[model samples]
Target: MPLALLALAISAFGIGTTEFVIMGLLPDVAADLHTSVLTAGNLVSAYAIGVVVGAPLLAVVGVRMSRKHLLIVVMGVFVAGNLLSALAPDFGWLVAGRVIAGLPHGAFFGAGSVVAASLAREGREGRAVATVLLGLTFANIVGVPAATLLGQDVGWRATFLVVTGIGVVAVSALAALVPYEPARPQQSLGRELRAFRDRRVLLVLATAVFGFAGVFATYAYLASIATHVMGLEESSVVWVLALCGVGMTIGVAAAGPLTDRAALPTAYAGLGGLAAVLIAFAFTAHITWVAMVMVVLLGAVGFLMTAPLQTMVIRFASDAPTLAAASNHSAFNLANAGGVWLGGVAIASGWGWTSCALVGACLAIVGLVIALTAGQTAARRATA
Candidate 1:
C-alpha cells in the first residue's frame, strides 16, 4: 500500500470516531445542554442526514477539482466542524456542528477510494480500497472506545476537540502524502449522473443498502440483547462490542484479497454467510458463551461483503466512479437507519430480544437474492 493510503485511513479514523463517540456521551451532552438524553440522540440522526445529503452532493460539486485538493478541502471541513462542536454553546449548535462534520464523511471515502485505486499497483485495487477502510474498522476497536472514555473522564466537549486535532493531522498527512491527480476532462455532472443509469451500479447500491442493513439490525440492539437475552451484566456489554470490533477488523483484512480474486463471488459468500450467522445467532442468544461467538461471526460475515460491494460499484460505474463510490457510503447509512428501525419494530411487536437476529437473517437473505440476480443479469448481458 502507498503511504498515501495512510493519509486516507487517518481521515477515515477521525470521521469514524466523531460519528460514533457521540453515542457514548449522550447522557453527558444532555446534562450539559439541559436537554433529555432522547433529544441528544437526535445528534446522531443529524450527522446521518448530513452524510446522506453530502456524499453525492460534494462529489458532484468537486467533480472538476483535483482529487488531492478535494480531499484536503473535505478534511478541512471536518476539522472546522469538530472545532465548532467543541465550542458549541447549546444542543442545537452541537447538532449543527455534527452535521457539518459529517458533510465530508462520504465524500472523503468516495474520492479516497478512487485515489487509492489509482495509486495501487495493478491487480491490488481491492486491497488498496480495503486498506483505506481499515481505518474505519480499527476506529470501532480503538478510536470510539478511547474517545468515549475521554468524554466520560474529561468532558464531551473535550472529545470533539481531540477529534478536531486528529482531523488537522489527517489534513496535513493528505496534503503531504497524496500525489496530485488533476480532474479528468471527461468527468462532469452529466457523466456522473449517467453512472446511476447503469443497472449494475443500481443493483450494487441496492445490495449495499439491504446487505449491510442486516449487520446493523443486530448491532444496534446488541447491548440490549446482551443484557436481556444473554444474561450479561451491564459492564460486559463493552466487551461484547469490542469483540465485535475485533471481528470487523479481521473480516475487512480478509476481504481485500478475496475481492481481488472475484468480487461477486466474494459478495455471494459474504451475504450467504451473513444470513447463516444471523439465523444461528437467533438460536444461540440464550447461551452466553455461544452468543459471544455469534457476535464475532456476525461482525465478520456482515463486513466481509463491504469491500467487494464497494469494488463492484466502482467498476460498474467506471466512467464516473467517484459519485458511485460516494453513493455507496450513503447507501450504507440508509442501511444503518433502516436496520435500526426494523429491529426496533420487531422488539416492539413483543418478540424477544433475539427476534432482531431473525429479522436480520431475513434481510441478509434478501440481499443475497438481489446479488445473485444482479450477477445473472450481468452474465446474460455479457453473453448477448
Candidate 2:
C-alpha cells in the first residue's frame, strides 16, 4: 500500500470524529447554545445537508485541479470548518461551521478513491479503495468515542478544536506525501455528469442508498435501544457503541481482501448478513448478551458493503467516475435521513424501537433486489 493512503486515512479520522461527535454531545450543545434539543439535532442535519449539496458540486469545482491539490484544498475546508465550530458563538455559527466542515468530505473521498486506484497495481483497486475507507471505519472505534469523552470532560467546542488539530496534521501529510500531479488525464464536467445517465451507475447508487438505509435505521435508535430496551446503564452505552465500532473495524479489514477477489459477491454476502442481523436484532434487543453480539455483527455486516459499492460505482462510471464516486456520500446521507425519519415514524406510531430493525431489513431487501437486477443485467450485457 502507498504511504499516501495513510494521509487519506488520517484525514478521514478527523472528518469522521467531527461528523459523529456531535451526536453524542447534542444535549451539551443544546444547553450551551440555549436552544432546544431539536435545534441542536438540526446541527447534525446541517452537516448532512452540506455533504449532500457539496459532494458533487465541490467535485466539479475542484475537478480541474490536480488530485493532490484538490485533496489538500478539501482538507483546508475541513480544517476551517472545525476551527469555526470550535469557536462558534451560538447555534447558528455552529451549524455554519459544521456545514463548512462537511462540504469537502465526499469530494475528498471521491478524489482519494481515484488517486488510490491509480496508485495500485492492476486488480488491486478494491483493496486500495477499502484501505481508504478504513479511515472512516476506524474512526468509529477511536475518534468518535475519544471525542465524546473529551466533550464530556471539557466542552464540545474543545472536541471540535481537537479535530481541527487532526485536520491540520492531515493537510500537512497530504502536502508532503501525494504526488504534485495526477498520472491520469482529467475528465470533463460533462463527462463526469454523464455518468449519472448510465443504467449500471444509477442502479449501483440506488443500491448504496437503500442498502445503507438499513444500517442507519437501526443505528439511529441504538442509544434508545440500549437504555430502554436492553436496560443498560447510560454509562455502558458508550462502550457498547465502541464495541460496535470494533465490529466495523473488523468488517472493513475483511472487506478489503474479500472484495479484492469477488466484488459483487462480497457485497451480496454483506447485504444478506446485514439484513439478517437487523431482523434478528429486533428480537434480540432485550437480551443483553444477544444485543451486544448483534450490535457487533450489525456493524461488521453493514460496513462490509461499503468498499464493494464504491468499487462498483467507480467501475460503472468508467470514463468519468469522480462525480459518481463523490456522489455516493450524497446517497449515504440521503439514506441516513430516510432511515432515521422512517425509524422515527415507526416509533411515533407505537411500533417501538425494535420496529427500526424491521424497517432496516425491508430496506436491505430492496437493496438486495436492486443488486440482483444489476448483476443479472451486467451478465446479459457481458454475454451480448
lDDT for each candidate structure: 0.90, 0.88
- Cα lDDT tens digits for candidate 1, 1-384: 579999999998899889878877888999999999879978988888889988998998899999999999999999999999999998889989988998898899999998988888878889998999889888888998888889989999999999999999999999999999878998899999999998988999999999988998889888889999999997677678778888888888899999999889999998999999999999989999999999998878888988898888888888889999999999988888899889889999999888888999899999999999889878887799
Give candidate 1 misplaced runs (Cα > 4 Å): none
Across 1-384, the per-residue lDDT of candidate 2 in tens digits comes to 689999888988888788877888998898888999887999888899889988998899976778899899999999999999999987889999999999998898888888888788888888888888889878889899899999988999899999999999999999998777752555678888999888888888898899889898988888889999999998777787788888888888888888789888888988899899999999989999999999999999998988888888888887888889999888988888888888888888999889999999999989999988888877787898
TM-score of 1: 0.97
If scored against the real structure, what TM-score would every candidate get?
A: 0.97, 0.98
For residue 249, model 1's alpha carbon misses the true position, in angstroms, by: 0.8
Candidate 2 residue pairs that clash: none
C-alpha RMSD between model 2 and the true structure = 1.2
Estimate the Cα RMSD of every predicted model relative to the unseen true structure.
1.2, 1.2
